[model samples]
Target: MMYPPPESQSLKTLLPETPILLMGSGPVPVPQEVATASSIVISHLGETMKKIVARVQLMAQYVFQTKTTKIFGISGPSSAGMEMAIGSLLWPGRKVLVLNLGTFSARFAEMARGVGAEVKEILPQGLAPIYIEQVREAFEKDSFDVLTIVQGETSCGVKNIHLKEIVELAKSHGVLTIVDAVCTLSTMPLPMDEWGIDIVFVGGQKGLSAVPGISLIAISENTFQFISNRTQAMPHWCLDPRRAFKFWGLGEYHYTAPVTGILALHEGLRLICEEGLEARFERHLKCSSALQNSLEAMGFSLFTPAEFRLNSVVAINNLSNVNTKELISLLIKECHVEISGAFGLDIIRVGQMGEQSRFENIERVIRALAFGYGKFGHKLDLESGLKVLNISRDSGKK
Candidate 1:
């Protein structure tokens, strides 16, 4: 006369639990202040009437190290940022050479093609980082008007390290550089001006730790000139950067932006400056290193190579032993932690930026993983994990 213990008794039988950690896409959890900040007028003229737009632009200038040209809040998600930036600058019949390391880079190439540009994608030879030599060969053979790179290719755990060199090379050839820094900006130091990056886009969800509605696009003066000279009509209405500048600048916006998102992003930028960029980046490094070490110690292979691993998120190979869906469910229900599993890539991405970058929390996450797997009849060493986790946390700090 006994009853079943519970559906989740064996990890295999449990319903998927909500990830407690919530680190999957950008537009991550925003700080309370972002919501609390009173939104100003949404009218194009209203932008100049109040200090909100000015403050946001100033903060961006401080954080990104770029002189104020213009800033605008587009309505769509982060992808919209790329679209707006690319749509504004790419002209029909111009040749564009893309550095496609992952999904986002492929998206960039598609967007370029949509604008009627002749596109060529440079696919990496293997699972390694995109070698500088490969890029050099591509540049030597092709004369492209635009070059695109994803700074931290979240789809694959490859961070494009030769971005500076690529940007310089593009400049030498009179090719405009477009960068998707959606996952890299705040987690890593991005001195856009120094790097010679022409057009850069970042999402609020990733490094910014703000809500998803706000996407930032910063353009260099040269890129601005390129956009001004484009002959074809831009496909999207709200995505027109020149119209945005008119609104965010002295003129009224030809269209409206997401007013609330702009408010939140302003405060988010303030928080980042208050925290100090170097300290924030160091914290991110420490957390990522710890997570990588813990996973490796527990017999998991990292999808990202040692040299090109991104700071904000680490991708762990699923391997043969574990069912990723079951593992995520157990960790969520039993541990109240959230980690993201990549599609197409057999890996789970753990975030370590903003509020989630706590040492104890990272250690707790490892423990939960250990316990979660143990429940599934997998033998795990909880005792030895303690030693390995500590070593990882310690080494990552240095």
Candidate 2:
């Protein structure tokens, strides 16, 4: 018996010769340092790995704006991080109040239901963000064991501006809060401890600009106590934080940890700390405002209004004359730039996440969008849009 020989291919033709620019909803380009970190893989149980893991936790706390040491990285995506929160906290007959705002909120409800929890969702139809009054009404109407919400809805670029207030109301009703900050953390201000958030999770691919596959999760002391006293065992062992903490917290073996992803996440969090949260927020805001204004000037409509729009990801409505799918093709195939089409929505999303929010990339994306629109036989105010972008860049220097 012998192993079969492998087929051979030219390395030159293995990938696209021209680098495709990632201006999409997530998995945006990582910085040089973060990319370099991902290549350094050491023994998962070694002392060097322990220090990296500790630094990651400390940096994650800084990014999450929390003092809780319960923060740790998950070997899966944000959904896995969220699954840990949902499965560990809820069991059969438990009730959850879902402030259904967008795609991810709907997913939270589905995941809660899967855990045998009673799910009640309050969805504000259309592109509007969930109002505080709606949340207040839900709390007053019935008692719930937990409340889950998204700080920023990635699907349509809508954000809950009243997140802190909503969390306070939930706490008043004795309901624990779990926030999905996958697209918001490090890109904007989400003071977890300050707002009394019980459980918070983030995806490294978006705001943190790390490659996909690793996500961060944190829990408050109160939430930890609740999980510790759960009636049933957690639904999953790999997704459970109690098992994960043995490796991330106590420096022990849990699984063959994704060392590369952890190192990349560590670098991402370090970059966020080095830039400082305030400056990072300002950068995202500056770039997003410019991108939004430029799009509007080019006669493109946005999915959500500026007041409650998510800055990290901006959704551009597919106008009556242009199909978003076709436009996305033009952006990718011809323009060498890429964006995302909303699932079952007449909108497309362009990312304003970490490296995507860089000034030069912002300009490049705007120019590529203009080119795509022109190719589709739709004349846009390209000069006007560029003028607005230039003005924003100049004003930002002050």
Instruction: Give the Cα lDDT of each candidate.
Output: 0.76, 0.89
- For every model shown, the clashing-pair count is 6, 0
lDDT of 2 by residue, 94-170 (tens): 99999887788888999999989999999875778888899888777889999999999998888988899999999
lDDT of 2 at 188: 90
Candidate 2 CA-lDDT value: 0.89
Which model scores highest in TM-score? 2
Q: List runs of model 2 lying over 4 Å from the truth.
A: 1-6, 10-12
> What tens digits encode model 1's per-residue C-alpha lDDT throughout 171-280?
88888888888888778887889888888888777787777767888877767776777778877778888777776665464666567777778888999989888988
Residue 360 error, candidate 1, Å: 3.7
Candidate 2's displacement at residue 119, Å, is 0.6
Model 1's lDDT to the true fold?
A: 0.76
User: Which sections of candidate 1 miss by over 4 Å?
Assistant: 1-19, 25-27, 38-49, 388-398
What clash pairs does model 2 have?
A: none
